[model samples]
Target: MPRRNEDALNFLLERRSVSHKTLTAPVPSRAEIEVILTAGARVPDHKMLEPFRFLVLEDAALNRLGDAVADRARALGLDEDKVAKARFSFDNAPLSIAVVASLKQTDMIPEVEQTLAVGACCTSVLNAALASGWGANWITGWAAFDEPFLQDHLGLAAGEYVAGFMHIGTVRSEPSERKRPDLNAITTWVSS
Candidate 1:
C-alpha cells in the first residue's frame, strides 16, 4: 500500500485562491517561477501529446499585455468600466502566467480530452503558486475569448486558446472564503 500524506490532504482542503486585485508586488523570482512552471508541466498528457504551454508575464511584459487589452477594448468602443476591467487583470498583477491550450491534431486523442488536459494544467499551475506561498487567481475574461484580442495580444495560433491566466503575487490580505458546493448534492454513485 502507498503511504497516505495527511499534510498534503490538509493543504488541499484549505486552499483558496487569493483575490487578484489584492495580490501585490514581490512576485516570484524567475528561478522560483521556473520551478512552478515545471510542476505544472508534470501532469497527465494523453497519448503523450503535450497540449499545453505557459507564458510568463512579468515587469514590462505586464504593461504590454495590459495596454494591448486596453487598446482592444477601446477600439471595440467598450464603455469605460468594461475597458478598465478588461485591462485590470493584466495590469494589477506583479506576475502572471498564460496557460495556453494549444491542441494539435492527433488520431489517438479526442479534442475534448486535449482540452481537459489543458484545464488540468491550469489547476496545477494555480496550485503550484499557492503552495509556494504566493497569492494566485485563475482568470479568463472577455479578452481571453475575443478573437482579435487573443490574436493580436497573445499571439495564439489558429487552434490555440488560453485555458486561463494565473495571476500570482504577494497578498495584501487573506481572502474571505466564498460559498462552496454541496458535494453530496452534485455527486452520484452507482454500484452493481
Candidate 2:
C-alpha cells in the first residue's frame, strides 16, 4: 500500500497559470523565493550534473530588463505595438525568475536530456510558486531567443539559454479555467 498525498495530487490536477498582467505587487519575500528556488532545483538530473541555474529579477532589475527589451525591439525595427508587447511582462512583473539552461559538457548526459531537465526545473518553480498562494506565470519572448539580448543583458554563457522567465506576484483576479486537452486524444496506450 503506497502512501498517496491526495492534496498534492489534487493541486497538480487543478493547477492553472495566472496571467502576468494580473500578477500584482507584494511579491514573495527573499526567504519565500529561496524556498521556491529550493523546490525548483529538486528536479531529476542525470549523472548528477545540475545543468540549470536561476536569476532572481525584482524591482529595478525588472524595469531595466523591460527597458532593454524595448530597446532591442526598436533596434530590430519592430513597431511600437510589438515593442510594447515585448516589454509588457517585465514592465508589469513584480518579480521574475529567469530559469537558465546552463548545459554541462558530458558525454554521459546528452544535451537534449540536460535541456529537458532545465524545462523540468522551470515547471517545478512555477508549481512551487503557485502552491505557495502566489500568482505565477512562465513566459519567454523574443528577448529570450535573441542571442545578443541574452548574452549582453542576461549574461548567459555559450551553452546557456532561457528555459523560462517565471513571474511571481499577488493575484489580482481569479483566472477562469481555460479549456484542457482531452486525455484520450493525446494519450497512447502501451502494454506488454
Candidate No. with top TM-score: 2
Q: lDDT by residue for model 1 over 156-175, one digit each (tens)?
A: 88767788999999999999
What's model 1's overall lDDT? Answer: 0.89
What are the lDDT figures for the candidates, one per model? Answer: 0.89, 0.93
Q: In model 2, what lDDT does residue 166 have?
A: 99
Q: What TM-score does model 1 achieve against the real structure?
A: 0.95
TM-score of each: 0.95, 0.97
**Cα lDDT over the full model 2:** 0.93
Q: 135 in model 2: Cα distance from truth in Å?
A: 0.4
